[model samples]
Target: MAHPVDVHVGQKLKQIRTLRRHSQTDIAQRLGLSFQQIQKYEIGSNRIAASRLFELAQIFDVSPAYFFEGVNGANDSEVTPCNTSTTISKALAAIEDETVKTRIVTFIEDISGMAVGRQG
Candidate 1:
Protein backbone atom coordinates (compact mmCIF):
# COMPACT_ATOMS: atom_id res chain seq x y z
CA MET A 1 0.00 0.00 0.00
CA ALA A 2 1.19 3.47 -0.72
CA HIS A 3 1.85 5.86 2.10
CA PRO A 4 -0.82 8.45 2.75
CA VAL A 5 1.62 11.26 2.21
CA ASP A 6 2.55 9.90 -1.20
CA VAL A 7 -1.09 9.62 -2.14
CA HIS A 8 -1.79 13.18 -1.07
CA VAL A 9 1.20 14.51 -2.92
CA GLY A 10 0.21 12.65 -6.07
CA GLN A 11 -3.30 14.07 -5.94
CA LYS A 12 -1.90 17.56 -5.52
CA LEU A 13 0.42 17.01 -8.48
CA LYS A 14 -2.45 15.93 -10.68
CA GLN A 15 -4.50 18.92 -9.59
CA ILE A 16 -1.66 21.31 -10.34
CA ARG A 17 -0.99 19.69 -13.69
CA THR A 18 -4.62 20.00 -14.66
CA LEU A 19 -4.68 23.62 -13.58
CA ARG A 20 -1.69 24.34 -15.80
CA ARG A 21 -3.62 22.82 -18.71
CA HIS A 22 -0.83 20.37 -19.38
CA SER A 23 -1.39 16.84 -20.52
CA GLN A 24 0.44 13.93 -18.94
CA THR A 25 2.63 13.68 -22.01
CA ASP A 26 3.49 17.35 -21.76
CA ILE A 27 4.46 17.08 -18.11
CA ALA A 28 6.38 13.90 -18.81
CA GLN A 29 8.35 15.58 -21.54
CA ARG A 30 9.09 18.60 -19.38
CA LEU A 31 10.25 16.37 -16.54
CA GLY A 32 12.25 14.14 -18.86
CA LEU A 33 10.12 11.25 -17.73
CA SER A 34 7.80 8.83 -19.48
CA PHE A 35 4.06 9.36 -19.44
CA GLN A 36 3.80 6.14 -17.50
CA GLN A 37 6.08 7.59 -14.87
CA ILE A 38 3.86 10.66 -14.65
CA GLN A 39 0.84 8.43 -14.28
CA LYS A 40 2.58 6.45 -11.60
CA TYR A 41 3.43 9.62 -9.75
CA GLU A 42 -0.14 10.90 -10.03
CA ILE A 43 -1.50 7.61 -8.74
CA GLY A 44 0.99 7.33 -5.91
CA SER A 45 2.29 4.06 -7.29
CA ASN A 46 5.78 5.56 -7.18
CA ARG A 47 7.27 7.69 -4.49
CA ILE A 48 8.61 11.06 -5.66
CA ALA A 49 12.13 11.81 -4.54
CA ALA A 50 12.92 15.10 -2.84
CA SER A 51 14.85 16.37 -5.83
CA ARG A 52 12.02 15.42 -8.16
CA LEU A 53 9.55 17.14 -5.87
CA PHE A 54 11.63 20.29 -6.11
CA GLU A 55 11.56 19.94 -9.87
CA LEU A 56 7.82 19.59 -9.76
CA ALA A 57 7.49 22.70 -7.61
CA GLN A 58 9.43 24.62 -10.19
CA ILE A 59 7.38 23.21 -13.04
CA PHE A 60 4.17 24.04 -11.23
CA ASP A 61 5.43 27.52 -10.35
CA VAL A 62 4.46 26.90 -6.75
CA SER A 63 6.47 26.96 -3.57
CA PRO A 64 7.57 23.62 -2.11
CA ALA A 65 5.36 24.45 0.85
CA TYR A 66 2.38 23.94 -1.43
CA PHE A 67 2.96 20.20 -1.45
CA PHE A 68 3.27 20.10 2.29
CA GLU A 69 -0.08 21.74 2.69
CA GLY A 70 -2.27 19.58 4.92
CA VAL A 71 0.65 17.19 5.36
CA ASN A 72 1.77 15.95 8.70
CA GLY A 73 5.45 15.19 8.75
CA ALA A 74 6.78 11.70 9.50
CA ASN A 75 6.42 12.45 13.17
CA ASP A 76 2.65 12.57 12.58
CA SER A 77 2.42 15.16 15.29
CA GLU A 78 3.74 18.09 13.31
CA VAL A 79 1.13 19.19 10.83
CA THR A 80 2.40 21.55 8.21
CA PRO A 81 0.61 24.81 7.75
CA CYS A 82 -2.10 25.02 5.12
CA ASN A 83 -1.23 27.38 2.30
CA THR A 84 -4.37 29.19 1.16
CA SER A 85 -2.49 30.52 -1.83
CA THR A 86 -2.33 27.02 -3.23
CA THR A 87 -6.08 26.71 -2.97
CA ILE A 88 -6.43 29.85 -5.04
CA SER A 89 -4.01 28.49 -7.59
CA LYS A 90 -5.91 25.21 -7.75
CA ALA A 91 -9.18 27.07 -8.19
CA LEU A 92 -7.66 29.13 -10.93
CA ALA A 93 -6.73 25.92 -12.75
CA ALA A 94 -10.26 24.49 -12.74
CA ILE A 95 -11.63 27.55 -14.45
CA GLU A 96 -11.63 26.98 -18.19
CA ASP A 97 -13.32 30.18 -19.21
CA GLU A 98 -11.05 33.08 -20.04
CA THR A 99 -13.60 35.56 -18.76
CA VAL A 100 -13.68 33.77 -15.44
CA LYS A 101 -9.93 33.91 -15.23
CA THR A 102 -10.00 37.59 -15.91
CA ARG A 103 -12.64 38.13 -13.29
CA ILE A 104 -10.68 36.17 -10.74
CA VAL A 105 -7.55 38.06 -11.48
CA THR A 106 -9.35 41.35 -11.12
CA PHE A 107 -10.89 40.26 -7.86
CA ILE A 108 -7.54 39.20 -6.51
CA GLU A 109 -5.99 42.45 -7.55
CA ASP A 110 -8.74 44.39 -5.85
CA ILE A 111 -8.32 42.40 -2.67
CA SER A 112 -4.58 42.89 -2.74
CA GLY A 113 -5.03 46.59 -3.22
CA MET A 114 -7.34 46.71 -0.26
CA ALA A 115 -4.80 44.84 1.85
CA VAL A 116 -2.06 47.21 0.81
CA GLY A 117 -4.23 50.18 1.66
CA ARG A 118 -4.89 48.75 5.08
CA GLN A 119 -1.19 48.17 5.65
CA GLY A 120 -0.37 51.69 4.55
Candidate 2:
Protein backbone atom coordinates (compact mmCIF):
# COMPACT_ATOMS: atom_id res chain seq x y z
CA MET A 1 0.00 0.00 0.00
CA ALA A 2 1.19 3.49 -0.69
CA HIS A 3 1.88 5.70 2.29
CA PRO A 4 -0.70 8.41 2.79
CA VAL A 5 1.87 11.17 2.65
CA ASP A 6 3.29 9.79 -0.56
CA VAL A 7 -0.18 9.53 -2.06
CA HIS A 8 -1.03 13.07 -1.04
CA VAL A 9 2.16 14.38 -2.56
CA GLY A 10 1.55 12.45 -5.74
CA GLN A 11 -2.00 13.79 -6.10
CA LYS A 12 -0.77 17.33 -5.54
CA LEU A 13 1.99 16.79 -8.08
CA LYS A 14 -0.48 15.63 -10.70
CA GLN A 15 -2.79 18.58 -9.98
CA ILE A 16 0.01 21.08 -10.34
CA ARG A 17 1.37 19.42 -13.45
CA THR A 18 -2.02 19.46 -15.12
CA LEU A 19 -2.70 23.02 -14.03
CA ARG A 20 0.60 24.13 -15.58
CA ARG A 21 -0.22 22.31 -18.83
CA HIS A 22 2.85 20.13 -18.54
CA SER A 23 2.93 16.78 -20.21
CA GLN A 24 4.45 13.86 -18.36
CA THR A 25 6.84 13.44 -21.25
CA ASP A 26 7.94 17.03 -20.91
CA ILE A 27 8.63 16.71 -17.21
CA ALA A 28 10.43 13.40 -17.70
CA GLN A 29 12.58 14.71 -20.52
CA ARG A 30 13.47 17.78 -18.53
CA LEU A 31 14.50 15.54 -15.64
CA GLY A 32 16.21 13.02 -17.94
CA LEU A 33 13.77 10.36 -16.80
CA SER A 34 11.18 8.17 -18.48
CA PHE A 35 7.52 9.08 -18.76
CA GLN A 36 6.77 5.88 -16.88
CA GLN A 37 8.94 7.15 -14.06
CA ILE A 38 6.99 10.36 -13.98
CA GLN A 39 3.76 8.37 -13.98
CA LYS A 40 4.98 6.33 -11.06
CA TYR A 41 5.85 9.46 -9.16
CA GLU A 42 2.47 10.98 -9.92
CA ILE A 43 0.61 7.85 -8.81
CA GLY A 44 2.60 7.43 -5.61
CA SER A 45 3.92 4.09 -6.77
CA ASN A 46 7.40 5.58 -6.46
CA ARG A 47 8.63 7.95 -3.83
CA ILE A 48 10.37 11.10 -5.00
CA ALA A 49 13.66 12.01 -3.40
CA ALA A 50 14.10 15.40 -1.82
CA SER A 51 16.42 16.56 -4.58
CA ARG A 52 14.08 15.46 -7.32
CA LEU A 53 11.13 17.04 -5.49
CA PHE A 54 13.08 20.30 -5.43
CA GLU A 55 13.70 19.99 -9.15
CA LEU A 56 10.00 19.45 -9.73
CA ALA A 57 9.17 22.54 -7.70
CA GLN A 58 11.59 24.55 -9.81
CA ILE A 59 10.10 23.16 -12.98
CA PHE A 60 6.59 24.09 -11.84
CA ASP A 61 7.72 27.53 -10.63
CA VAL A 62 6.45 26.75 -7.14
CA SER A 63 8.20 26.37 -3.83
CA PRO A 64 8.87 22.89 -2.45
CA ALA A 65 6.27 23.76 0.16
CA TYR A 66 3.64 23.93 -2.53
CA PHE A 67 3.12 20.19 -2.54
CA PHE A 68 2.17 20.21 1.13
CA GLU A 69 0.04 23.33 1.23
CA GLY A 70 -3.40 21.77 1.72
CA VAL A 71 -2.28 18.77 3.70
CA ASN A 72 -3.17 19.84 7.19
CA GLY A 73 -6.61 20.45 8.77
CA ALA A 74 -8.21 17.50 7.02
CA ASN A 75 -9.64 16.31 10.37
CA ASP A 76 -7.46 13.26 10.03
CA SER A 77 -4.01 12.51 11.33
CA GLU A 78 -3.15 10.95 8.00
CA VAL A 79 -2.73 13.51 5.27
CA THR A 80 -4.72 11.65 2.66
CA PRO A 81 -6.65 13.59 0.05
CA CYS A 82 -10.14 14.58 1.03
CA ASN A 83 -13.06 12.39 -0.01
CA THR A 84 -15.14 15.04 -1.71
CA SER A 85 -16.71 15.68 -5.07
CA THR A 86 -14.57 15.13 -8.14
CA THR A 87 -15.74 18.58 -9.12
CA ILE A 88 -14.07 19.92 -6.02
CA SER A 89 -10.79 18.29 -6.94
CA LYS A 90 -10.98 19.57 -10.47
CA ALA A 91 -11.86 23.03 -9.22
CA LEU A 92 -9.00 23.01 -6.76
CA ALA A 93 -6.51 21.71 -9.30
CA ALA A 94 -7.12 24.77 -11.41
CA ILE A 95 -6.41 27.13 -8.53
CA GLU A 96 -2.86 27.91 -7.43
CA ASP A 97 -3.93 30.24 -4.64
CA GLU A 98 -4.13 28.48 -1.29
CA THR A 99 -6.26 31.19 0.25
CA VAL A 100 -8.77 30.90 -2.52
CA LYS A 101 -8.88 27.17 -2.20
CA THR A 102 -9.51 27.50 1.53
CA ARG A 103 -12.38 29.83 0.85
CA ILE A 104 -13.81 27.43 -1.67
CA VAL A 105 -13.65 24.63 0.86
CA THR A 106 -15.44 26.79 3.39
CA PHE A 107 -18.09 27.68 0.88
CA ILE A 108 -18.61 24.06 0.02
CA GLU A 109 -18.91 23.17 3.67
CA ASP A 110 -21.50 25.88 4.24
CA ILE A 111 -23.58 24.73 1.30
CA SER A 112 -23.19 21.10 2.29
CA GLY A 113 -24.69 21.84 5.70
CA MET A 114 -27.69 23.47 4.08
CA ALA A 115 -28.12 20.41 1.91
CA VAL A 116 -28.14 18.24 5.01
CA GLY A 117 -30.62 20.55 6.66
CA ARG A 118 -33.01 20.27 3.74
CA GLN A 119 -32.62 16.52 3.57
CA GLY A 120 -33.30 16.16 7.27
Candidate 3:
Protein backbone atom coordinates (compact mmCIF):
# COMPACT_ATOMS: atom_id res chain seq x y z
CA MET A 1 0.00 0.00 0.00
CA ALA A 2 1.15 3.57 -0.63
CA HIS A 3 1.99 5.75 2.35
CA PRO A 4 -0.57 8.26 3.56
CA VAL A 5 1.97 11.04 3.16
CA ASP A 6 2.45 10.15 -0.49
CA VAL A 7 -1.28 10.23 -1.09
CA HIS A 8 -1.65 13.58 0.62
CA VAL A 9 1.27 15.03 -1.31
CA GLY A 10 -0.11 13.77 -4.60
CA GLN A 11 -3.52 15.24 -3.93
CA LYS A 12 -2.04 18.59 -3.06
CA LEU A 13 0.19 18.57 -6.12
CA LYS A 14 -2.73 17.81 -8.37
CA GLN A 15 -4.86 20.48 -6.79
CA ILE A 16 -2.17 23.14 -7.09
CA ARG A 17 -1.37 22.17 -10.63
CA THR A 18 -4.99 22.35 -11.64
CA LEU A 19 -5.49 25.66 -9.85
CA ARG A 20 -2.54 27.09 -11.72
CA ARG A 21 -4.01 25.80 -15.01
CA HIS A 22 -0.98 23.66 -15.70
CA SER A 23 -1.10 20.42 -17.62
CA GLN A 24 0.99 17.35 -16.88
CA THR A 25 2.97 17.95 -20.05
CA ASP A 26 3.77 21.51 -19.03
CA ILE A 27 5.06 20.50 -15.64
CA ALA A 28 6.90 17.58 -17.15
CA GLN A 29 8.67 19.84 -19.57
CA ARG A 30 9.57 22.29 -16.85
CA LEU A 31 10.81 19.55 -14.56
CA GLY A 32 12.67 17.71 -17.31
CA LEU A 33 10.60 14.61 -16.67
CA SER A 34 8.20 12.63 -18.81
CA PHE A 35 4.45 13.20 -18.64
CA GLN A 36 3.99 9.65 -17.37
CA GLN A 37 6.35 10.43 -14.48
CA ILE A 38 4.31 13.46 -13.58
CA GLN A 39 1.14 11.37 -13.72
CA LYS A 40 2.69 8.81 -11.40
CA TYR A 41 3.68 11.52 -8.96
CA GLU A 42 0.20 13.00 -9.07
CA ILE A 43 -1.37 9.56 -8.42
CA GLY A 44 0.94 8.71 -5.46
CA SER A 45 2.39 5.73 -7.29
CA ASN A 46 5.83 7.34 -6.88
CA ARG A 47 7.32 8.48 -3.62
CA ILE A 48 8.96 11.87 -3.98
CA ALA A 49 12.31 12.42 -2.35
CA ALA A 50 12.89 15.38 -0.08
CA SER A 51 14.99 17.29 -2.59
CA ARG A 52 12.57 16.54 -5.39
CA LEU A 53 9.69 17.58 -3.19
CA PHE A 54 11.45 20.87 -2.55
CA GLU A 55 11.86 21.36 -6.27
CA LEU A 56 8.21 20.64 -6.82
CA ALA A 57 7.30 23.07 -4.06
CA GLN A 58 9.32 25.71 -5.84
CA ILE A 59 7.68 24.91 -9.12
CA PHE A 60 4.20 25.08 -7.65
CA ASP A 61 4.94 28.25 -5.63
CA VAL A 62 3.88 26.59 -2.38
CA SER A 63 5.64 25.60 0.78
CA PRO A 64 6.54 21.98 1.46
CA ALA A 65 4.17 22.11 4.43
CA TYR A 66 1.29 22.70 2.05
CA PHE A 67 1.54 19.16 0.76
CA PHE A 68 1.42 17.77 4.27
CA GLU A 69 -1.47 19.94 5.40
CA GLY A 70 -3.91 17.20 6.34
CA VAL A 71 -1.43 14.69 7.71
CA ASN A 72 -0.84 14.03 11.40
CA GLY A 73 1.58 11.49 12.79
CA ALA A 74 -1.17 9.54 14.48
CA ASN A 75 -1.89 5.89 14.65
CA ASP A 76 -4.67 4.44 12.51
CA SER A 77 -6.88 4.11 15.58
CA GLU A 78 -6.48 7.77 16.51
CA VAL A 79 -8.66 10.34 14.84
CA THR A 80 -7.03 13.73 14.31
CA PRO A 81 -9.48 16.57 14.02
CA CYS A 82 -6.82 18.91 12.70
CA ASN A 83 -6.26 16.66 9.69
CA THR A 84 -9.95 16.69 8.82
CA SER A 85 -10.11 20.48 9.09
CA THR A 86 -7.00 20.85 7.01
CA THR A 87 -8.45 18.63 4.30
CA ILE A 88 -11.63 20.70 4.19
CA SER A 89 -9.69 23.95 4.14
CA LYS A 90 -7.52 22.71 1.30
CA ALA A 91 -10.57 21.81 -0.74
CA LEU A 92 -12.16 25.17 -0.06
CA ALA A 93 -8.99 27.01 -0.99
CA ALA A 94 -8.97 25.28 -4.36
CA ILE A 95 -12.20 27.01 -5.32
CA GLU A 96 -11.08 29.72 -7.75
CA ASP A 97 -14.35 31.45 -8.58
CA GLU A 98 -14.56 34.80 -6.88
CA THR A 99 -18.32 35.01 -7.39
CA VAL A 100 -18.81 31.68 -5.72
CA LYS A 101 -16.76 32.80 -2.76
CA THR A 102 -18.71 36.00 -2.45
CA ARG A 103 -22.02 34.15 -2.60
CA ILE A 104 -21.00 31.66 0.06
CA VAL A 105 -19.72 34.37 2.33
CA THR A 106 -22.86 36.43 1.90
CA PHE A 107 -25.04 33.45 2.63
CA ILE A 108 -23.14 32.68 5.81
CA GLU A 109 -23.31 36.28 6.90
CA ASP A 110 -27.05 36.42 6.28
CA ILE A 111 -27.61 33.28 8.28
CA SER A 112 -25.54 34.61 11.13
CA GLY A 113 -27.40 37.92 11.10
CA MET A 114 -30.73 36.12 11.21
CA ALA A 115 -29.62 34.00 14.15
CA VAL A 116 -28.47 37.10 16.01
CA GLY A 117 -31.73 38.87 15.28
CA ARG A 118 -33.70 35.93 16.65
CA GLN A 119 -31.57 35.86 19.80
CA GLY A 120 -31.92 39.60 20.45
In the order shown, what is each candidate's alpha-carbon RMSD? 4.7, 9.5, 7.5
Model 3 misplacement above 4 A: 76-120
Write down the worst ten-residue block by lDDT for model 1: 77-86
TM-score for predicted model 1 compared with the true structure = 0.66
Q: For residues 17-69, what per-residue lDDT tens digits would candidate 3 score against the true structure?
A: 76566888998898889989888887778988898889889998889888776
Candidate 1 local lDDT, residue 56: 93
Clashes per model (N, Cα, C within 3 A): 0, 0, 0
Candidate 2 weakest ten by summed lDDT:
80-89
When 1 and 3 are scored with lDDT, the better candidate is 1
Cα lDDT, all candidates: 0.78, 0.79, 0.73
lDDT of model 1, residue 1: 86
| Clash pairs detected, candidate 2 | none
Per-residue CA lDDT of model 1 for 10-109, tens digit only, reads: 7788877875778999989988999999999987789999999999999988997777667776665444533465577777877889998977877777
Regarding TM-score, does 1 or 2 come out ahead?
Answer: 1
lDDT of 2 by residue, 1-120 (tens): 887677778888888787566889999999999999999998888999999999999999999988776676665347846445334567777788989976776677677684455332
Q: Model 2: runs farther than 4 Å from truth?
A: 73-77, 80-120
Cα error, residue 78 of model 3, in Å, equals 8.5
